[model samples]
Target chain A: MRVLAFLDGTLADPDAAHIRVDDLGLLRGDGVFETILVADKNPRELRPHLDRLARSAAMLELPAPDLEGFERAARKVIDSWIGGRELALKLVYTRGIDGDPAGVPTAFAMGLEIDEKVQRARTEGVAAVLLERGFGPDVAERAPWLLLGAKTVSYAVNMAALREAGRRGAQDVIFTAADGSVLEGPTSTVVVAKGRTLYTPPSTIGILPGTTQYALFRGAEKAGWTIKVEPIPAAELTTADAVILASSVRLVTRVHTLDGVALPDSAALHRELVAAYESEY
Target chain B: MRVLAFLDGTLADPDAAHIRVDDLGLLRGDGVFETILVADKNPRELRPHLDRLARSAAMLELPAPDLEGFERAARKVIDSWIGGRELALKLVYTRGIDGDPAGVPTAFAMGLEIDEKVQRARTEGVAAVLLERGFGPDVAERAPWLLLGAKTVSYAVNMAALREAGRRGAQDVIFTAADGSVLEGPTSTVVVAKGRTLYTPPSTIGILPGTTQYALFRGAEKAGWTIKVEPIPAAELTTADAVILASSVRLVTRVHTLDGVALPDSAALHRELVAAYESEY
Candidate 1:
C-alpha cells in the first residue's frame, strides 16, 4: 500500500498526514469523504465521486475542496501503486483544527489494494441480516441537520451495524427504515430484480446515492432493463427474482440469503449486472 | 494548549500523537470520548466521566479502555498546564487503524484553555432553537446499533444542529423527537423548572444521560428541590419557570429565548443551581 496526501501544495507521504488532534473532523466527525476504484491506473467514475464529495462538503457547510488539487494528488498516488491490480483510492476533506471557525480544510488522498473481504463477498454471494435503521422515511425531509443524504465520515452507526451482523454470523446487513422499508447496505446500495425490471430504494429516503449503482443502472437501462427507484419493503426483497449490494470497490455482489431465508438465485442476472457495471466504468 | 497521548505505555507530545489515517476512529468515527473541566488544577467529576467513557466504549463494542492508564495521562497533562485557570481536558479512545480488527486502541489526553464562546455561554445564558432529532424515544431500546445513549465521537449531526442554530442566530439547540417530545441539547442535557420541581428528560429516551445534570440534581435534591424525569414537549418549555442547558464544561446556561420566544427570567434559580454545581464539584 502506498499513501500520498495533498499537504500545502503537493503530494506527501501519508505517514506525514498527521492532522491536529483538535481537527473538527476527528473531534466531531465534521467532514466528508469519497472512495474511488482504480483499475489499470485509472480512477473509475472520478467525476461522479468528486461531485458527491462536493455535495457532501456543502451539506456539512465545510469549505469546498480544491478538486483540481485533489485530482493531481489522486493521480500521483495511483501512478505510484503497483500496476495491474485493483486499488482503492480515497479522498477526504475535514473542517480542520477546532476553535478556528472558518479554518482551512484538511484534504488528503491515499491508495490501497481492495480488501480481500470485499473481493470474497463479490465472488461468493453474502448472507445479509436485516437491521432497523431507526428512522422513518419522512425524517430526512423534516430534519436536514441529520445529514442523512450526505456521506459524512460520522459512520459509527454503520460500523456498529456491520459488527452486529458479524456477531450474528452474517456477512453483511441491509438497513430498513422503522416502517420496514428497505434502506441500504451498511456501505453499499441495495438493488433488487423482478422479471426484467431492476429496482433500488429511492435515495430520497436518506440513503446515499451510490455512484456505482447509478452507473450500473445507466447500463441496465441501455440494455432494455426497466429501472425503478422506489420504496422496497422488506417483504418485497424475499420475493424479488434476484438481490444484490453494489458499491464502487465491490462492484455488484449477489445476496444469497437475507435474514436466514435463502433468496432466489439469479446467477445469470448477477453476471449480466456485473458485466454492465464493469462495462460502464 | 498542550496535548499528550498514551501510546503503548508512555505519554508523548500530541504532535507525535498521530495515528494511521486509516484508523477506524478517523475513518469511520468508531470511538468514544469525554471532556472534563479542570478547574484550579483539579479535574472535576473524573469518576463519572470515566464511567461514561467505559459505558460508551461498551456500547460501540470497542475493547474496554484502561481507566488507570487514562487517569494517569489526564493527571500528567493537567500537571503540565499552568494552574489557577480553567482548562478543558479531553480524553479520547478510538478503534485502531483499519484492517487491524484486534489492534490496540488509540488513547489521548489534551489540555486547552476553555473556549471563549463556551465561557460566555456559561455566564450570559444563550438563545436556543428547537430542532427535530429525527428519531422516536424508543429507537435506542429497539435498535441498539444507533448507539444513542453512548457519547461516541460520531457527532456530525450534533455539530450540524449547532451550525443550523448558528445560521438562525441562535447559540444552541434543543432536539425534539419525531413525536414532539423534547430530547436534549446538542451538547448539554435539557433541564426545565416548574415551581419547585426540576425536570429533565428521561435517559430511556436514548439521550446521553448528562453527568453534570445528574450531579446538579443530586445537589438540588439536597437543597429541597423536587427532581423529576419525564417527557417534555416543546410547547411546555415556554411555560416552565426557568429553562437551562447544563453540561460538564458549560456548567449551567439559562435559555434566554427558544425559537425566538423569550423565556421568563430565573436569576435566583440559576444562581442557586450554579452555586450547587460548583459546591458539588
Candidate 2:
C-alpha cells in the first residue's frame, strides 16, 4: 500500500509517522477525526467534512483545527498517489502531548487505499444486528458533555459493539437507544424507506448527523422522495421496504438482514440511493 | 522532568516515543489502559490495575496483553527514575497498526511526574458539579457491549465532563444516571459516608469498579465501618456526613460542594478515610 501521512503541515511516510505516546488523543481518546473518500484523486464533500471536524474539535474544547492546512495536506497526499484506486483520507486533530506548555494540537492527514472489507460490504449488502446504545434518546439534549453529536475519537464502545455483532455472525450493527428507538450504526447512519417516504432517526436524539445521508436526502428530495427526520422504533425497521447504512467511506450499504430476519426486498431502492449518493460528489 | 516510555518491550525516551498514525487505538479509540500511581518508587495496587487492564482488553476483544512484559517495563521505568517525586505510570495496549498482516498489539508503558493540580485536589476538597451520565443504571446489564465496567481509553466524554465542570467553576464532577441516581465521578468513584456506613454506587450500575475504593472498603470493614453498595440518589448527597471521590492517583478527594450546594461537614471522616487509604498501601 502506498500510504502517506501529512504531519503538522509536512508530509511523511505513513509507515514511519507517529504521534507522541502522551498525546491526549492516543492516551485518553481526546480527539476528533473525519474520513473522506477520494475517487481518482478527487476528494468528495471536503468542505462539509472539514466543517464537521471543526464542530467536533469545538465540542472537545480542543484548539480550532487548521482547515486550510488540512485542505492543502489532503490535496498534496491525493496528488502524490500513483494509482487510480479509491483512497480513504483520514484527518485527525488531537490534544497535544500531556503537560506541554504550548498545548499545541497534533494534526495529521493520512491516505491509504480503500479496504477490501469496506468494498465488499458495499457490494454485497450486510447482515446487521440491533444493539442497545445504552443512552436514552433525550440524553444528548440534557447532557451536551456526553458529546453525542460531536463524532469524537472516543469510539471504544462503538468498536466493541461492532465486534459483538461480528461474534454473532453479523457484519454490522444498528444501535437502538435505551428507549428502543433506532439510533444508528456503529460507524454509519441508519435510514429506512417506506413507499416514497424516507425516514432517519433525528439528530436531535443525539446521533451524529450523517454527511452522506444528508447528501442522499437532498438528492432524494429532488427526486420526489419525502424525507422525514423523526424517532424510529426498532419494530418499524422490519416493516420498512428497505434499510441502509450510510457513511462517507461506505456510501450507501444495504442491510440484507437485521437480527437474523431477512429484510424486505430493496435492491432497486439501494441502487437509486447509491446513484443519488454518487451524483452528489 | 525525566520521562520514560516502554515501546513494546523496549524502554525509550518518552519525548521521542510514538505510535503509528494508523494505530486503531488512536483512530477508533479501540484500546484499554491503566493509570497506576507510583509513590516513593512503589506502584500502589499494581495487581488490581493489571487485572482490570486484562479485563478491559478482553472487553475490547484485543489480543491478550503480555502481563509479564508490562510488569518488567514498569519496574524498569520506576528504577530509572532518580527523583523522589510521585509518578503516574500509564500502560496502554491497542490493536496494532491498520492493515498489518500479523495483527500484533501495540503495547507501551509511560512514566511521568504527577501533576501538582492532582495533588492539590487531594489535599483540599474539590468543588464538584453534578452531571448527567445519560444512561439508566440498568443499561450496563442490558448492553454489555457498552463496556461500562471496562476502563477503555475512550475517555473523551469523561474529559469533556470535567471541562464542563471547570467551565462551571468546579474542579470535578459526579455523574448521575438518567433516572436521577448518583453514579460515579468522571475519574473517581463516589463514596459517601453517613455515621459508620460507607456507601458507593454498585458496579452493576455500569460504573468502573474502583480499585482504590475497594481497598479502602476492605480496610474500613476490618475497622468496624459498614460498607454498602447501592444506588445513591443525588438529593441524598447534600445530607451525607461526608462525600469523597476515590481513585488510584487522587486517593481520596473530599467534595466540598456539589452544584454550588455545600455538603455537610466531614473533616473528621476525611481524616479517617485518608489514614485508611494510606495504610492499605
Candidate 3:
C-alpha cells in the first residue's frame, strides 16, 4: 500500500496527487529531498532527517521548508499505512511556481514499500566500481554555490553513476575525487572498517553527510570503536578489513569487490554495524 | 494564454493536468527537457530541438523519446497560444514510474509567456561574472556519465550559479573550466565578436550545442563574417570587440560588464547580431 500526503497533512488520492506543471522541482530540479526508512511502520530518526532537510534548504537558498508540516505529513502517512513492516518515506520540497514572488514552496511526503533491490543489496552485498566524480577537496569551501553538501534533487549525475555501475556488471559505484581521494557512493556514504575501528570521509570533502553513517559512527563510538573522520585514498579501500556503504533506507551494505577485484567482507562486522545503526532509533 | 499538451497532442487544463507522483522526473530529476522559443506563435527551429532532446535522452541512456510525438505535442501547445507575441515551448521527457520495468517514459509539452527578466536581459544587456564550474575540457569524453553535454532536468547547479550571479551584483554567469578554458553560460552560450569575426567555444568543451548560436554563426558566415569554432580562454572574453550570450528564448544579449568593469556598449553590433540570428528564421 502507498500513502501520499501534502505538507499540511492532507491526504490525496494516490493516483491523482499532482503538482503544478510549472513547479521548479521538475522543471529545473531546484529542490531537496530525503529518503527515510520506516521500521515497524514508524519512521526512524525523523528528527535528524528533518534537520538535514532544513540544512539542505539553507544550502539551496530556497526558503526554509516547513519542517513541522513535513513531520506531520510524514507521521500522518506512516501511521495510516496498513501494510508492510518497512516503508521508504520521502520528503520533497521544491521552489514553487516559477515566478511567484510569494516564494511559496511545494512540499509533500509519501510512504512507499522498500524496493526489493535495496533488500538484495543489504543481504547479498554489492560490487562497486571506482569512478571519477570530477571534483577536488577544496570544492566545498571554494564553491559553495555547487551545493555539494546539500542533497538537492539534481541527481541525474548520481543516477548516471549507478547506470555506469550496471554497465560494468556491478551493482554500485564508489566515487573518487580528482586527487584520488575516496568519495561517497551514488546514493550512499562510504565506510571503511578495520578490526574494531570504523572510518569515514569527512563532510568537508564536498559530499553530503549521510545521516545513517553518522548514527552508525556514533553508535560504534559508544561501543568502543574508534571512528576516524579523515581523508581516505581510493587505494586504501580495497585493503580495508571491511568496506561498507551506508544510507538511511539501505542501512549498511558491505562491498564484495571493487573494479572486479575481490575485497574483504565481514558478515559479522555488517551485523554489528547494522545493530549500531539500529540502536540509534 | 498558457497551454499544456501530452505526447498524443491531447490538450489539458493547466490546473488539472498532473503526472504520477512516482515519476522519476520529480523524484530523482531523471529526465531531459528542451525550451523552444515560439516566434509569432511558431516554434523556432523545432527540428533541432527535437534532435537535441533525443541526443540528451541517449546520453542519459534513457529509452529513446518519441520525437514525432514531441513535435506534435509542441505544435499542439504553441498553436493553441492566443496571447502574447512570443511563448516559450518546453518539451519534457522523464524515465517514467520508478519501479516499473516496462520503462514507459513521461513526456509532455507546455507553452508559457516569456519571463520579463529574460526580456530585460536581452534589451538592456546583462552584467556577467566568471565562475569556476568544476569540470575540465575532457569531461565529456572522460566521464560521459556526468551528463555534461546533455540538457537534463538536473539544473540545480545552473540555478545556484544564477543566484550566485545575483549575489555578486551580476545578471548572468560564464562558467569557466577547471583548467581556465571558457565554457558556456549557465542558460546561454557565450559568443565573442571581434570586428567582422565571431568566435564560440566548440561543443567539445563539455557544453551543450546552442541551437541559436549555431544559427547565428551559420547566418553570419553566409554574410561574409569569419566564424571560428575554437577554444576560448576565459581571459579572451574581456578583450573581444563585444561579448554576447545567446539562447533559444533569450535570443541574443550583450554583456555590459565583466566583474563591474564596464564593457563596450555596441548597440549597432547588438542589432547586427540580432539580425543575423533572426535571419535563421
TM-score of chain A considered alone, across all candidate predictions: 0.96, 0.97, 0.97
Clash pairs, candidate 1, are none
Stretches of candidate 3 exceeding 4 Å from the true structure: none
Q: Which of the two, 1 or 2, has more lDDT?
A: 2
Task: Report the TM-score for the A-chain of model 2.
Answer: 0.97
- Please give the RMSD to the true structure for each candidate, in Å: 1.7, 1.4, 1.3
Ordering by TM-score: 3, 2, 1
Worst 10 residues of 2 chain B by lDDT: B1-10
What is the TM-score of each candidate's chain B when compared with the real chain B? 0.96, 0.97, 0.97
Candidates 1 and 3 compared: the better one by TM-score is: 3
For candidate 1, give the lDDT of residue A27. Answer: 81
Best by DockQ: 2
lDDT of 1 by residue, A1-281 (tens): 66666733465655553766777778888889999999888799999999999999999988888888888888888777874478999898888777775698878888877878988988888999999988899898778899998998899999999988988889899999989899999899999999999999888998899998899899998888999999999999899998989888888999988888888887888998888877775
Error of 2 at B177 (Å): 1.1
> Residues B86-204, candidate 1, lDDT per residue (tens digit)?
88889989887777757888788888778789888887899999999888888888889889999988999999999999999999999998888999998999999899899999988
Ranked candidates, highest DockQ first: 2, 3, 1
Model 3 lDDT per residue over B163-215, tens place: 99999999999999888988999999999998899999999889999998988
